[model samples]
Target: MAGVFGLAEGEVKTGLRRAARLVLDTLYPPHCLACDAAVLEPGTLCGACWVGAAFQTGLSCDKCAAPLPGDPAEAPVLCDDCLRVARPWSHGRAALLYGGTGRQLVLALKYGDRHDIACPAGRWLARQAAPLCRADTLVLPVPLHRARLFHRRYNQSALLALALARELDRPALPDLLLRTRRTGIQDGLSRAARFENQQGAIAPRPRRARRIEGRHVLLVDDVMTSGATLAAAAEACFAAGADDVDVIVLARVLREE
Candidate 1:
């Protein structure tokens, strides 16, 4: 019968697609981003890599997400660095401490063309940032200068922001924040120097300023070191009449040494 033949054809097509997928997977099995060892799933690390990653949990600083030393009962403590410096954002969270596997993952994503890492990393960030997400929250990434954007071809922060936005069901506006000027690398810079370098580096786009007005804006970045860059970005959002600004990073540089 005609109906029977159509069902058989549909089954054959499904079988062909499954066979193709199996062949492709065999040729290029998913591998760990950090160690290059084959993993059971994509966007995941191997067992050894997971063991090395220092994920931030438990009691932490309310402002910067720094790991607190004392008993869990004494929470909401501000770290020494936060106490001395006034951060622009109200709250911040980081998925991993910037060392060991976390450092390796960040390097791979930023330089090694490993964009797949964003999915897993963003999912983790989404969980960490959930407390800040709201119906009117606008999610965005730290913008890159035009020159650097051209050279890199893609902004890794934007990739993570996009993924995080999807997970949180928030509106992602990549162009909301603009890097008005380029600054030198912040590597090995003192805290004060980093703050000075980022001065006037970022601003909200004039045409898109209204989008940020009166809304909770969440800024995403690959890593946070001195908190200077994030502070600068949050300042811009606040200047544009944003109700509040929060930050979420894939990793946080807990120590320089």
Candidate 2:
């Protein structure tokens, strides 16, 4: 019957699906994932929420992604923190500042089971991580302790890393890194305490060492506060013989000035 309009069965089915989708969208319009405000499309934020998200823009620190306070055309600038300490990773990038809408987005994805937010967050991370992506680069996520993994039922870092791998066409090695020991929560921990808690917590899987040897690794994470976790993970990758390691995160905890 549909052949009368020159529409093949597959084409007719596709059209019907589109029509159904349109009707459904009209009935229950898409809402912002973070604020629940009505939006034109799903998996997005409303204008106010979008404006609140403090995304990192031009002229950032070369190693920490903190907004630099000098001329944009100046040589690669390092933040005071980066200059004070030698980081294990060669560089780092983050998409947003960890406050306001950014904080809401992270909390939603981290605790609310809003995995859908990973799509846009991962895309943003991919763009920020573009300078680190290369043919020989391998994407890896910060591993969660087995106990924590069991409790949470999923590793948010792994989710973001997998999404980034798809966007960059790179291989994601989630198992290459392992959390050998569980660490206490990082919340409210001082810088030195955070480092101590994460120390020796992450290690490369011995059986998968060959996969990381001599390759550039990109470490993906949900957020960077004091960066102690990423530092520990990058150190493990370096110990595993990775040529270099770079870090990328969905958000960076902005220090109060």
Q: lDDT of candidate 2 vs native?
A: 0.88
> Can you write out model 2's per-residue Cα lDDT over 1-257, one digit (the tens) per residue?
55538888888888898899889889989899788689988778899999999898878887878777777688478999999978889888999989999999989888889898888888889888887888999999999999988998888999899989988999998878999998979987788889999999999998998899999999999998888999999999989899999999999887732
| Candidate with best lDDT | 1
**What are the RMSDs of all candidates, in order?**
3.5, 3.0
- 40-134 per-residue lDDT for model 1 (tens digits): 87678899999999998777787888888887578668899899889899998999999999999999899888898899998899989998898
**Candidate 1 wrong stretches, greater than 4 Å:** 1-23, 71-73
Cα deviation at 195, candidate 2, in Å, is 0.8
TM-score per model over all chains: 0.90, 0.90
TM-score of 2: 0.90
